[model samples]
Target: MNIRFDGKRALVTGAGKGIGRDVVKKLVECGAETIALSRTQSDLDSLKQECPSIIPVLCDLADSESISTALKDCGPIDLLVNNAAIAICESFFDANTADFDKTFDINVKATIVVSQIVAKGMIERKAGGSIVNVSSQASLRGLKNHLIYAASKAAVDSVTRTMSLELGPHNIRTNAVNPTVTNTAMAKVGWSDPVKVKAMTSLIPLGRFAEVSEVVSVILFLLSDFSSMVSGSCVPIDGGCVAS
Candidate 1:
């Protein structure tokens, strides 16, 4: 299918690296005017070099005020991707309140904040829009040492559902993409151990983790008009891990 976003404007959080970066690139390639948001200015600079037309908004998701300020002049966006997240991986028994707070601050709270801001604009315009929340397979199934991370994503999925229910009347669709261990820099480090990789892949029927493009493809679908009827759904790009 040939999906194009010729005149659409998109805002992607955490667009400096990993899945977020790939999503930005894909949107640009598909003819969308994209806004890239990241906390790291250097990373955004590098991304600007790669995609010169992308608008960079440097906002730390942990701070509510910063989010407000960064988006003050962002204009109206047709698509919103809440992809910024931080995982403080620790066993449930070993996790601390600080880590839990930080994890939820970015993963859950910021997502709601950004979506609300963008959705309000869409509503006012009476044009409607799409929102894709980047969640994880951990939200669906328990994983070792991912207690807080899993909880945050679970909350994201909940927000996606509620947002879909409330916003559907206005024709704004909301959905979540839950990916497995994607082959990004962070995942490379977290799943670097040979034994751990083997054990994890063994559970997935496809016998491997996801590629950055694979996840990006799903996100693009959710944001595009092709999915006009799909909302409040958590689509898993887990290679059958969640199925098993």
Candidate 2:
């Protein structure tokens, strides 16, 4: 079966690289008029240079004002992927107020801001929309030095459920994709240790890390009409890691 979004519109955050970049490209391929939001001008430039059809909005996730200004005039979105986040590694012993504040400000607050604005548009249009929040397997089960990141994602999961309950009446759907340590640029930083990687992957039933495409595929399904009945669900894109 072929899935298409020939006339739909989509907005993706953290569309600079990795999962977000792939999602933007795939949406364009599937015929959605896609908007790519990134804090980095260079990443946006390269993405635009490559796709040529994406609407690029440069706004820092940490700055709510900038995000508001950037999206104030954007046409109503049919799908939204809240993929922008920062992972600050801090164990329980060393967790600080600064790291926690910064983590929640972007991961939790930014997701809420974007979803609220787009949801209002959807409600007014009465056309409905799908929201896919990029949560993490870390939120389901803890790991070493993931205190702030896990807390923020867990908060996002709550946001997703609340959005589903409130927005479902308007035909809007809200869900999240919780992925394990994927082989992305973000993974290269803390996951470079083979010993750590081995320990984590062993827990997964599939015995391997997640891939960028794997996560994006699930996000697309959730964003599309194919998942018309799926809402308030935290779908794991892990290699069955969460279940194990």
What are the RMSDs of all candidates, in order? Answer: 0.7, 0.7
Model 1 steric clash pairs: none
Q: Flag regions of model 1 displaced more than 4 Å.
A: none
Instruction: Report every candidate's CA lDDT.
Output: 0.94, 0.93
Tell me the tens digit of each residue's lDDT in model 1 across 1-244: 8889999999999998999999999999999999999999999999999999999999999997688789989999999999999877788899999999999999999999999899999999998999999999989998998889999999999999999999999999999999999998768656889998999999999999999999999999999999999999999999999999
The TM-score measured for candidate 1 stands at 0.98
Residue-level lDDT of model 2, residues 15-48, one tens digit each, is 9989999999999999999999998999999999
- Point out the worst 10-residue segment of candidate 2 by lDDT: 182-191
lDDT of 1 at 189: 51
Q: What's the lDDT for candidate 1?
A: 0.94
